[model samples]
Target: SLFRGQDWLQLNLEELQQSTTISGLLLELVATRDIREGEEILLDYGSAWETAWDRHLKAWTKSPGMYTPAHVMDQVASKLRTDEEQKEYPYADNLQTSCFYEYEQDTATADGAASSSKKKKREVTTIPWEMSRTIFDWKNLRPCSILQRSDSHHHQGGHLYTVRIRNRPGLAPNSRIPRGEMHLVSKVPRQAIRFTDKIYTTDQHLPQAFRYPIGIPDDIFPEAW
Candidate 1:
């Protein structure tokens, strides 16, 4: 295929990390809800992809890589094998950061056939992704997600991360994952990886959605944009 002619080009999406506008807006809203450190946060992969692409366009004024369709597979190789890759991902069943990105490599299949096996994976990077970082007032900053994990994922059916902050569960009044709900998180594309998506709502619907009381300090964010 395309890589047959060029191999290094396989590193196409290596440089980008995507985040969505809705994510940015919601993050702010989450922060206002007094989000504390180490809360499990989850955003849509598609939205994240869109954000990353937007970042690329803003800079290059064109698609970052694709580099085009020919090389796209090489860019997203790791995520294919769910069981294997998912096991390697950071905070797998816990509440910590989750990363979703593709890495290039050579591999084999079941039939003893040798072929290219690109996989998309989720894992934690070297840089510790802190959920608190997003609360700062930065203009046009890069988009990423971080969380305070609580439970752990064990071989057997073990308990998940408790998702605490400063040793407290209710620290962040309005949690990235609703107070009593389960949150699905993964690692970010770039170095600081962490980790979904569905449902849409306008500002007016905020109250009934998460239901964190208004004006609560370190509790929940303002409903209006």
Candidate 2:
């Protein structure tokens, strides 16, 4: 919004209002980055339009937080490069490296399979009690992820909350992560956010990165995943 060199509107917009830190906003913007499928990631630029130049070399030029966007671009570019320079790679094989949740539904389902028309367009009413034990257990709760918003307005008609399932490195190569990609949990809990609260009753692999403040109970989490 640089019109008269001063008067302007910042393009900075977000789905959340609680983010207050520069790094937090920066990271959110980075998370919106579109990295094309099937790409080997790179993180640097040598000259103005250079390939992934070593950061040690371009440390003097590029801004601090900008590296993420550039790296994502380079990764997409490399992904599209000719096969001569590329090797066989999996198509979104390791999501932990990307943690692209809420981008789409689970791919485990058979492609092109038909679902109920009402179920297709309508919002999923339940979280399959066995699936979301904690969220179901709550006396009153709100969905935390953006997918629900896509189907219906929030209970409060305000913005919705999000939970990012960050990368977990220790799972074996073929480990079967028996959990849905993401789920919604009430942002502000009526009671304190602990194991007794609700979320802890479900799988504990979830990250603590909730838009609303919440804590993990030590009993449920013998060790942080």
Best by lDDT: 1
lDDT per residue as tens, model 2, 1-225: 223312112322342234443332111113347788996676432243342233334543433221122234324532121122223532221111121222123422434323333633333222211123344343322222222221233324433222222223344333322343333222321121111112232222233211222333434321221
Residue 204 displacement (Å), model 2: 28
Q: What is each predicted model's overall lDDT from 0 to 1?
A: 0.29, 0.28
Give the Å shift of residue 129 in candidate 1.
13
- What is the number of residue pairs that collide in model 2? 3
- Model 1 lDDT per residue over 1-225, tens place: 322313222333332133221222222333347656998866444554666656655654332222212123324432222333346653222122223311111111122222223432422112212344443322212212333322343313322222111112222332222233222223222222222111132222333222322232332333221
Q: Which portions of model 1 miss their true places by more than 4 Å?
A: 1-170, 184-187, 194-225
